[model samples]
Target: MGDGRSGGGGANRPAWLQQYDLVGKIGEGTYGLVFLARTSHRKCCIAIKKFKQSKEGDGVSPTAIREIMLLRETCHENVVKLVNVHINHVDMSLYLAFDYAEYDLYEIIRHHREKLSHSINQYTVKSLLWQLLNGLNYLHSNWIIHRDLKPSNILVMGDGEEHGVVKIADFGLARIYQAPLKPLYENGVVVTIWYRAPELLLGAKHYTSAVDMWAVGCIFAELLTLKPLFQGVEAKATPNPFQLDQLDKIFKVLGHPTPEKWPTLVNLPYWQNDQQHIQGHKYDSHGLHNFVTVPQKSPAYDLLSKMLEYDPRKRITAAQALEHEYFRMDPLPGRNALVPSQPGEKIVNYPARPVDTTADFEGTVAVQPSQPVSSGNAASGNIAAASVAPSRSMPRSMHVVGMQRMPNAGISGPSAAAETKRSKYGNAESWLSSTEEALLRKPNGGHTCLFEIA
Candidate 1:
């Protein structure tokens, strides 16, 4: 998907590669690299995530399979949509295509903190948080738990009908939590250190969606203060070592958890075993107000405190938080997070994401596009006009309200093997048929709009 000369010897390139024009590389992580591209016919921008081979070198990575399976079952405006899946029989490489998001919370926060030198508007912050919670509530209701919820994973659409809408991306570490065959702990450590919940730090064998809420709390604080609430150094020890520094950071600000505050404090694996580290630790519990400047009784402070509660059981749920006084206050949450909610409010123009044209799909140096794509934003740097068609509308009938669970949402049965059989791009129907049974399954279990003034 380049100007036709990028990814080394292209003598046997898959025909599906020609459907899109490769724009540049947008992101990279432990799983794989993400590339920006435009559909050849529709001219719509999309993000293609290329997964790395499993460590066993046998087939597609389990993370890729899990992401695809879970995404297929979910359909929400705030959730990232998996547009298509492609494979290169030559290398058995798997690529997942999704709608391209021009801005993410990480970049938006950075622009305000480092470049603009200002705090994010209250209206913007509330709208973004509301959307995030709405998306998360939907997942939790369906028995899905997002193990990781960081700023970078929260994406904002650009220049389209969905423009300014928040889309939660990255499902690599997500899981269906209802009656998991194995304990959730078997999955080992999850979440980034800074956003990790106290229960996770204390080595709780059994946890709930509260872990995700704690992360949302951290993200909310960062949105206001322009910095991580807990900036602790992570230990490099293996086999899921206890994060002493992270715990220490939390305790210093929130004060040490007591049996009175959290009745189950004594039951945690680390609470008693790591006594030497916990004993004699004196911290000022009143320091939360120091970092976050809202009034003690303000709805904002009240919601933040509940979210950062040391007791996971006491933590606020996404549905409850959506109705909190913080969101009901003036400048209520809106559909478009980027727009100003009140009249005479100055708009905060966020910079577009940076694209690196040097790397191709195979992680090799590639020739840049002959012409600069016309990206609507002038601040989008080098990238121009990467227009996209309107997002496909998901039927309202698919929407589930209240608490409903998916019975067989958990991954079961043997892993699907990446077939060595070479096939043409048009053979996707057959390829899907071969793997659909292994990947698709049913499970059991269980947002408002705001108008913006022009």
Candidate 2:
């Protein structure tokens, strides 16, 4: 097996990770670092999310805990699958192994914008929107609300094959809706600023899945137009109303929103006093600005508008949005139809997340997922993504320093090669060994145990 100390401050490096060959850095966020790495046993591609360590004796943040717990149970073709978690006792860090994918939607959009015209074919848009809704539907059905949904959070795997699927990747802000329960915290605003729903903008104490729908609306508009629907310069207000005549701009083209048309307009807690503003009027700018900025709207516009409804209660549900006429007008084709088989690799199967270990690893101090630190959605919960400690509970955000695929020759033994083979084939058994299992059982020498089979 490959083993070596990486980076300065060797004290922070995990003992076991030395064996895996570091390929390169894939991404970086506030919480921790993500690296594309290959183990000695398999040539399989795996994305390792390393969490940062806190002084809390290898503990992870809370947000990571919810993400892990939910991912462990919710597996679907539309959602990214978290394969396995590794924790090392010596350095107190955690590593989450996920199935590697080709690229993210953000990159694809950016690439297409440069090579092709700003315009995108309707077929591609249809496929993407359908996949997005399907993933959202699955999440909502399980009573899990993905508080933060955006283009970047959607992941695409495989190459130009119809079977290549799009999966929703992040669950850092997801939560189960339960009445009469302890609030995670007061005023938790979880979606990205641009994709954030208006109700959330108004600081609504209790929100629902509609917030996600708003993000879908924003994404749809951006995809159709190749630009964010509500892109605007940040203003100084805490409630974060758009600086320009954004609302008016949307109304003139899509049609005006009057008290009679949208009766709930008067009810929003933070509804602006129009007369007090510069316009001193209702939608004087133009509604068609949205349509004018973009090309002609396909049949999809009708459905997209509903998801972007001003009233949270009136907004479409993920399930309802999936069944909307826009999607029904053009259904998603089978995987084989969209992307044909490539030369070397076989098609990826849906629901590819590795099964949770059933062994009794109660005493073992496996790493735990962490929680976002800030109250609203933007702050990554307490868990840093890059780490590998037995006591770590969550993945901490790490700086995505850099990544490279390790060569086959780097592996030393047949046993190691076999392990790598298992990983490539998605075999769960290869994740840990009998000795590792014994170590897991004793995660912490003594103290109340937190790591349990999900």
Candidate 3:
């Protein structure tokens, strides 16, 4: 831990303050910094996610809270594990400790691209895809939508044994879509621009996990081709109703969507208003056949086709895709993606993760290391719930994704005396020990990989 002391009087800190020794800054983001740490008692490795106050100088940011709650409740091998949480009484700062992972899909793809000697084999691809889908299926089945699903957000353990154990990290933009208290549309401008679904770009008020599925389809293509299939320049924010440039990029490769293909297509705000300007109708003749050249006629193509289906309702469900013929093919999916199929084949070597011991966490937010420009970025922003427009979908009394409480329920915060209240942990300041897992994961120098030190 650099300096170790975080603001306020040194000795007069919360009980949890002395529990761990901070190591070094692993990564930084808009909200805060993630540090590699170990517990004082057991010396178990942990990834501490520290969040500075929001602009108003309040408690934890709502986005951080959403992540804590989601990770705490979710228990899956493929999902990042949240070990414990703590709050600085003096500064009102928030911190979450999670199990550490080694590598991310972003780094993996970059490694393959930059390296001349090696490439990701097909068996590894099948394995990584299977694990990713497994985690995503868990999220969707729980009614939670991972609004941002890209290479960076998908983590892989560098433990060597669990080669295919991909942990879906970053829940800052994740929300439970079950019977939402506010219209799902209220959370506008979600998912990274590239992975964003066609329906969302068209300004569809009502959408579902299919949006996530669409992103997965994009990811699937990227893994196969070692590049983003639809690398559209993100349109600058505007008051207008459409993202014409992004839509055009998709149409140029996948062909224009017709009313016959997606029944509700014409009703969407962007498509209805700007149908005249949308170009590239002729590209539909070949569909995805022309775009994805490496993957030939197989069940993998079937799964990709279903995932990229224009009609979201018809998009392949996570469970269904897992059972696709693509997975059942000869090089059947494996548990260890990195393990070579042939016994004598070499185990791919990836670089070690860099640690910035000098990154000060005493004040301000940490910035992630910028990544090299590829076809486009993997992910960056998620503007859900920042919309200026009134929600168009019907509101209900149940839960809404990313919201602290039900709509109109009022502000949510813990009482100053909340320590005296009964909690899952004995006191408000508590610890839930995780295995403190640290695999050999690395981040590319070019990309800004953030969240729980994955």
Candidate 4:
């Protein structure tokens, strides 16, 4: 839409919908409906995404247009390939075609969660982690930021050796940072709450590809633990701009964000509010190091630390993460995610992910009007929060970048002058400490943090 749109017009090809036989609806969410279809001529399966038009007479949404533009330029094995596009002239329905993916990281993680005995092996974990980063590296290298990178959005091939190949799917939330037509945040919130980067959560206007790195950190943690690192309820956008509860959840683990630690912390629009919310929790790190139960004494912790660094600028880029000692150690990450079994180890044929042929997607937000949630379990309060329909939230990360994006300096973050104007926290010695170091340094009584570095 902003000079990047290749404009794949559907004027010439009429009756495009007739070409593929709709097998059944695969999925539906924020973007639109995904149908499993087979080409009439080739007989191979393909995914057809029917883009929803605005009900208020607005032609096609810019988000759909942006997706078409970004996917047109992005060509990588790790990224989903845009196969074909169709536009009905009369009703003006826009549809995008893609190769069908059999599994998403969410399904894989949930499968292991469901079956304790069928836990993913160590080599499989490393391979999936590596493939995820490899795809992410390709995206960041091209100056594009995948604003939304949760487990659900990362797809996996389901057959042969290619079955292990992970593909970065759904560009509806992805934006190119090539050359700027406007500031990144001008488009508003881009990422999902659980995987959102610290800078975005704190209302940083001009963010970098490090935002994607932060999400990668969360995904990496989920791969090891099978649960989100910082799973918190999203704050209502209109009533309150500040996400206190979410910030509280993060500080409970990562400790407080300060100027000494993150020079640009004070410059965030919501910094003072975050400071207030995270105040009493300082030095009260709620033993989160014990929660990230990954392999002990491995380089995995080091890589994760860099990825989840409080300062977005300090977070590991996808490229740097790939080269870290974690990937080099013990069971080196195999090219295929489905690693061969050892001599005596029994192979677990992890079942192919289930595809719901008749799942209803008409109602984006579903309320069990008859069935009420039990007040006894407070954890179930946020269950329906994630189901909110995706709307026209313009992402800040979409602006075009003229040059290659590089990691920022540790002191002042991605952009020094842009974020930190004056030092708010004057105590410089506190900079010597990190939250992870404090939590993993020793056990308070009998509980030891299993992720303690050697």
Q: Give the C-alpha miss distance for residue 249 in model 4, angstroms.
A: 1.3
Give all candidates' CA lDDT scores: 0.74, 0.53, 0.64, 0.63
For residue 344, give model 3's deviation from the true position in Å. 1.3
RMSD of each: 9.8, 15.7, 14.3, 17.9
Error of 2 at 333 (Å): 3.6
Off by over 4 Å in 3: 2-15, 160-163, 239-241, 279-286, 363-454
Q: Lowest-scoring 10 consecutive residues by lDDT in candidate 4?
A: 1-10
List TM-score per model, in order. Answer: 0.82, 0.66, 0.75, 0.73
Model 1: lDDT of residue 32 = 89
Q: State which candidate has the highest TM-score.
A: 1
For residues 241-331, what per-residue lDDT tens digits would candidate 1 score against the true structure? Answer: 3798998889888888898989998988888787788755666675788888578789998999999999999999988997787876777
Q: How do the residues 1-454 of candidate 3 rate in per-residue lDDT, one tens digit apiece? A: 3224533234543456556565457677766888766667765566778886555434336677667656765777788888777655344456788876666777778778787434578777888898788788777766678998999888776543343468898887887665423456776678887888999888888888898999999998888877888887876767432577777788877787888989988788877676457533344555687777455477777788899998999888987887777776657665556556555555565532445544434543334332221111123342211111122121121111221311211212222112212233342123212111110022211111123322
Where does candidate 1 stray beyond 4 Å? Answer: 6-11, 367-454
lDDT winner between candidates 2 and 4? 4
Identify the candidate with maximal lDDT: 1
Cα error of candidate 4 at position 17, Å: 2.0
